[model samples]
Target: MTKIADFRAMTPDQLSDELLKLKKEQFNLRFQAATGQLEKTHRVGEVRKDIARLQTLLRTKQPAA
Candidate 1:
């Protein structure tokens, strides 16, 4: 559950790192689902949205840099 303001406060490098971390979590969540080991199913959607947010923010920031 990340806020847009929190993402906006981060530097581009920090945002990239956060995006990578979210992607890893997304992978793990997918694996868990495949194995039927996932409990909090809603987290997958959350991570996906967070990753998208980071990507969008990065793109918006890039044009200004």
Candidate 2:
């Protein structure tokens, strides 16, 4: 699992890619949970937090108009 600090240091494109991957994983986790196949339910919270962290970093890095 990647650290939030490391993610914050990434370029926008890298952060974007990571965000997309995290979203996909979140979807899978939800599906697994619905079917009672989730091995680690805690991972869902971590992924959601990571996505939020990435988004926050992206917003902070954006140049103001």
Instruction: Name the candidate that leads on lDDT.
Output: 1
What is the lDDT of every predicted structure here? 0.98, 0.90
TM-score of each: 0.96, 0.92
lDDT of 1 by residue, 1-65 (tens): 89999999999999999999999999999999999999999999999999999999999999664
lDDT for model 1, please: 0.98
Model 1 misplacement above 4 A: none
Q: Candidate 2's residue-wise lDDT over 3-23, tens digit each?
A: 877986799999889899999
Clashes of 2: 0
Pairs of residues clashing in candidate 2: none
Error of 2 at 47 (Å): 0.4
Model 1 clashing residue pairs (backbone): none
Q: After superposition, how far is residue 1 of candidate 1 from its true place, in Å?
A: 1.0
Candidate 1, poorest ten consecutive residues by summed lDDT: 56-65
